[model samples]
Target: MEGGVMKEEGNRLAKEQRLRKAVYNAIITLSECIVETTTLQRTLNNLDQSSWMEVVEERYLGRMCGFPLCTNPVQVKNAQKYRIDLKNKKVFERSAEIDKFCCRSCFLRSAAVRAQLEAEPLWIRGDEQVKIFDLNAENVRQQQQDTYDVEFVEDQQLITSLEILKIGDTAESDDEDNDDETNMDEEKKDDAHKEFYNLCQSYLTMKSAVASIDEIANDPTVKRITDETVTKMEIEAERKDNKRLSESEKLARIRSKYSQNKFKRPPEIIEAKPFNSELCDKVPENLYQDFKRILSEWCGPETICHLQLHRRMNLSDSENKTVTEAKSIIAQFYAGDRSINKIVEDVFLPPVDNVDQAKQRISVLVELLKPSWRLLERTLNRNGCGQQALEIISTFRLSATNVILEKKMCDLAVAVIFRLLAYCDRSLMDFYPSDHIVSSKFMKYLEQIRCDAKCYFGILSIITNKLE
Candidate 1:
């Protein structure tokens, strides 16, 4: 009885399992029919040079592949860009527009063709022939400019010819083989020679040397050193031309030299205390001293040294005192002490109607940063700065970015940005922020008050002038 019952139970279980399998198969078959009826897949044409497509930059992640015909999953490891390309027509739903291609084949087949982009971008192209022609012309012009020149600017830099250097570089080339090394054209070489000649000629106005056995006894550009000054009297006294002179006389001379050198050496400089009746007597000595101490805290000691704010270096006593007064005035301005005119008469401290008076206040600082501004301008205009520039005329000033609707000013701002990368590479201008308020770039533009300085300042003076 137990065998018969167990067999009947096994047969019922088997029938039920078979019925479940048949239902599962039916559902899968219906789903496959639905997919075949509703969907279409087009076989891609072979990718050739003429049919080649390039992926644009700025790929993004999406739930579905961006390619209109593709249904593949996007892999995180591979970045792909997609765009519709066939006849430049975009029929994909807006939601699917951002979806990127899952595979390289989809990208190659659907992305805008590199050749067709010259005619017009695939997604934006229309049946408008006029716009298409205009774009093609522009692209052709751009293609012409794609070739880059690899020439160096330093090649054009004027080398000082040590040969005939004192006489100046003439129309002659001394080295016959140097013709191969020379990089400049005829016009550039001529200009370089002219510039070098002019620099040498500037020293013509200097006075002749004093009569002395010393080779450079009175060199003006150089400070003579015995070290400092070997006096004419000392030079002459040291000469022992008469060998017959008594031993007592020679001993006396030696004794005199020892005593004089120890107790009464000649002064290197004539010392005089400067006293200006108008300026020095009225300056706030106590307040200015306090300002210098505070200045170091605010501006750091290095700034004081770089700008010579602590004391104007390399000036005569009278000039030194005058420059100290000017620096004090600048310090006062920095300290927000606007009543500088009350402290030092006839000298204005900003907020002045007279432009010259404004310039006079900061004349001392301009003499410091003229070289940095020069480097910025020259580097911007150089050949290998990675800029496709024919003309760049303006200062790299932050203030000029405020011009409203002026095309010329707009061009200048763009030029500054365009040249910035090149400027960073080549310019000697400091990129790091200056530590103190006094040495900051905001305070750049102290200028030389000479004809050469004026010529060099040129357009940049517009920015530097305000700093002065």
Candidate 2:
């Protein structure tokens, strides 16, 4: 019976020891888990920097009804004004086991509250330039670079091993596939895998390149150097400005010193000569008088009357006196004893005796008229009575003695006639070769008559048509 009791006691002792060990292990594990949880929670809460706060239960001597947290001096002051006992000191200092770990939810709540209180709204001030945060393509590119760098550091060895394994697998697979069809299938799969691998490598290479770029972009030393360079450049620019001003002043002084005297020398005095050595000597005295007499006689009053007739008589107001008087003047010059009425009847009046004869005569005149119509055109253009002058010139056929100005009148007449013929009456083309009227003979005569007065449109038309 004693032996059975001893065996039972030994078994009970072994069971108790096992149970105690299990409880101790569970306690240690729980404590360690709590510590790890607190650490993780603190990190997530962004409270790696935190101060310890002790919680205490105090008994107030006065009537403080509820537990109100006295956060600030104002709260305490208010509580004191309400006659409430606000105790910040510990009342009972007794040792008690208490949990000292970060409450995951409480830590997050505190962090959020702190963040809310600390965060400032993005705002533009009236007097201050706001810092512009550009979170555009450059920011995203930088973020991508950071992510790639981390991924590469974490998986570089793994990727290299994976490649080795893939190559071995491919070799084995190739060896196992002996049939042509199976070999082709394996080759296609290998090619697909190679393409995938190459794509991955390309992505990694691109990512690595981007990361290196970011490293350069974010390098503080490079930024400092750039800022220093800009500062020096600004200083140098100011120096250059000052130097330029100094140089300008120096140049101004130099110019002032040299400009005291006039740079230009006085021109040499030159005596005026009476006449040139090559100038022609005087002409004979009688020759000058003869020339004057010829001019006076040729352009005298009778010539003026004849030229007026060429310019046409506006005898609607003169009882035909202008035509009659012009004929009388010419007769007076031509014949010593000729009656004005006879001279008029012979020269001024048309050869036709009646209206029927006049119409026939007009027909004959139109048929016999040369392009010397330019005479009236010139006389009319000069004297401002073009239509009447043209009628007179077209109608009258003066004698050679009376036609002293015939050449000028005829040349002017023919030029204007060509101008009219070139463009005016297309119907008259049957009667005259309009093309022949613009001939060199006609244009040369116009040049000799009109002098510097250019026939621009007429000349252009002639040149263009001839070239064509």
Candidate 3:
């Protein structure tokens, strides 16, 4: 971020330098034109350092197109002569222009006599004057950086260093007064405690605090520490604070502070994970699948699927209602969510312009599968009809493949193969300890064909022959 800021600042400085050079040359030429140098100089002089940017920016910084209507800048070493059509009065020059004239010939419109401009160049010596203008532009920038300006007044009343030292030193020594068996005289400690307690109660009510302060100010029991009493060895303590309070008043202040400390004590510290530069990408398999895994770990029993959206108009009431309900689902599927499959389908088979097929062809064999699937499963379990069932299944697959029907027709073909296998109580995804068939490779073949579910469904059906 610092490098980016420095680069931006450097670019700005370079641009400013370029603009300053142009403006200087323009100013020198202007001073020569009228035989006077003070008008712009006066404008520069009147401008405050913080406000001169507007004057610098308002000055034209580059050579512009000579064609009257166009204010576009000219970058070429030699600008082309301006050409215009007589009838329409449109200037012609090329700098990424897009117009009706650019696309085609304009021979129909008559050409006009070209306008010419002539000006003699004059050299001048005005560096001292223009240098000041450049410096003022820089000054405008520097003036913006001075953000802090308010000077705070220092409090200089007598808060001597020994008082601050006393506040710290009392931490250990003051605890002795709270105990009954302390060596300090019992009456003296009780008297000090009573004075501190009364001071606290008066301060809390604050009604007679001023009067009490006046009466207690002259109390001889208050041991005063004067400038001479605070020895040279304790002079370092003076630097902490300049206030010098009497011993009795300091004890009251310490009791008051300790009473308040209980309410403002900070909360317990919590352990935080340390910053780590090395990041581990746990799933190198797939990004989309990894995203689902991460969210699954975070949410656990509460399952969620990603639903990305793009720029769109307001959804209809029906769509919004359905989407919200689907988003709230807690149960997840192993394969993928419905939306992921839909997106994959769209990518692999983008909808053609006019080829959004309305319906699939209903072959007679395809029609028969709806009812015959169960009946075929029953008969194929017996001996003779096994090859017959296989032939019928193959015929259905070939017909559908040749016709190029939609995905559902292909799925119906796979259903036939699974039904016979199920009738015999064989299955995939389950392990029956005594059963021979626990899983099938047919599902894998179907996936390899991207779930088109090929119509070759009858190859794996079991046949049992009874010996007579």
Candidate 4:
């Protein structure tokens, strides 16, 4: 009886010890689960920089209250106004009509309800009840048959080992057979355990590889870095495209600026005449007589003697020849009563050896005619012969080219030209062609000379005013 009691006590102690071990293991597993859950929550919070309160406010603002049993608006109000310390929680009160919660009470109640719903296990939720169905008789039988098959396989292995052992033993005793079968069964269990351990190790290795892949794929830092790199590449490409467009536009503008009037042709030559018939018709009898008197004085014997002395002193061989030819032509025009057109065409338009000869002949003519320029200007202005005077001056100016003039001569020429232009009709000025003195190229050349002279000239102001 004591032995039976001791045996019962031993069995009860072993059962109690086993139960204690299972409870300890359960506690450890629960603790580990809680740690894992907290770690996952922290990781998620770190990834999203916004606090839970801000997230909730952003999601629920201007929307209906989240509480299942309440109907209220949500609004963003000053957090300090709330009586509850909502810094660690997500709660807000109404300050306007658009608020989700009508009051602080409603917000708190909603939050509590949300927390309760989150805490409740899915299996215990009334709305999401899970119904477990029992296995049918055929399924139970199939499962049992599979278990029996596995046992049979193990037993077969044991039996084969026993048979091998028996072949090495000479004993035919039943006790020895039992012992050998037991040893074979133990060896088969050990082999099964080793196979299970190997399978578990392989499974753990595969799980670790999958977990590393997930970490690489889901890391926020990696994703953000990739996004920044793509944005930089796009920005660089855009800048390059903009730079290319700017360069093309700059080149186009430069071409347009320089080539604006480059291809324009020089003006055509017209019939030449010494006196304008239009001026003769407009001039009063008194002004016409004054003009003739001035012309006679300009061609008088004293002026002729001074010009001959000037030619002897300053004229080259070619220049003296040109001047002599010009004098003969003028004498023929006056003595033979030839038309002014014939004299201008034959005398002024004839080719010369060089620009210097042409210039010297022009200087001699200008010197001889200097006394008449002022008289011509006054007569034209008084008699409304401004257009005729301008035309005559422009023709004379065009006849002289590629010759550097003395400052005094250039000033005299510019002054005369400007005085004529000032009184002339603008329409008649435009009628003068491009190669004439009124053209852009001729005006620009005058401008360059004015700049070099640096002394202020009335011509500069006149030209600027006319151009503007």
Best by lDDT: 4
**Which lDDT tens digits does candidate 1 get at residues 44-161?**
1111222122211112233434343345555544333345657867654333423355765545444332333333322122221222211133445465567554666541223344
RMSD of each: 44.2, 43.9, 32.8, 37.1
Error of 2 at 214 (Å): 9.4
Q: Itemize residue pairs with steric clashes in candidate 4.
A: 73-99, 73-100, 73-101, 74-99, 74-100, 75-99, 75-100
lDDT of 4 at 78: 53
Badly placed stretches (over 4 Å) of model 4 are 1-214, 217-385, 397-414, 417-468
Q: What is the lDDT of residue 273 in candidate 1?
A: 75
lDDT of 4 by residue, 1-468 (tens): 999999998987776665445434323332221224333232221211122233334335435442323344544555565445467776665354225565665555434323322233222222332222221334444555786784323445445555645534535544456765545566755775676566557755876676776698689998999899999999999778667677778678568767566676889999777887556334233432342233332232322332333323333433224446676556555544333343344445545665554346546555543444444435334333333343333233223332333433433444444433443333324423532234443344434433222222333333334333
Q: Write the per-residue lDDT of candidate 3 for residues 115-214, one digit (tens) a residue.
A: 0101111112212232233223234435445644567764332123334334445556666555534554778656755765665565567765455765
Provide TM-scores for the models: 0.14, 0.15, 0.15, 0.15
Cα lDDT, all candidates: 0.36, 0.40, 0.36, 0.43
- Model 3 lowest lDDT segment of ten: 109-118
Give the clashing pairs for model 3: 159-242, 159-243, 160-241, 160-242, 160-243, 161-238, 161-241
**Which one wins by lDDT: 3 or 4?**
4
Candidate 4: residue 193 Cα off by (Å): 29
lDDT of 3: 0.36
List, residue by residue over 1-468, the lDDT tens digit for candidate 2: 999999998987776665445434323332221234333232222211111111111101122211112111111222222233358543443332111112233333333323322132111111212222221334544655786784334567546646755767767766777664353556756776787678678766876676777698689998999899999999999777667677778678668767577778889999987886334322233432342233333232333344333323232343334356667566556645333234234445445455443335434434333434544334334223233333333333344343333333334333433343323223223323454343344444445444322433433333234323
- In angstroms, the error of model 4 at 165 is 40
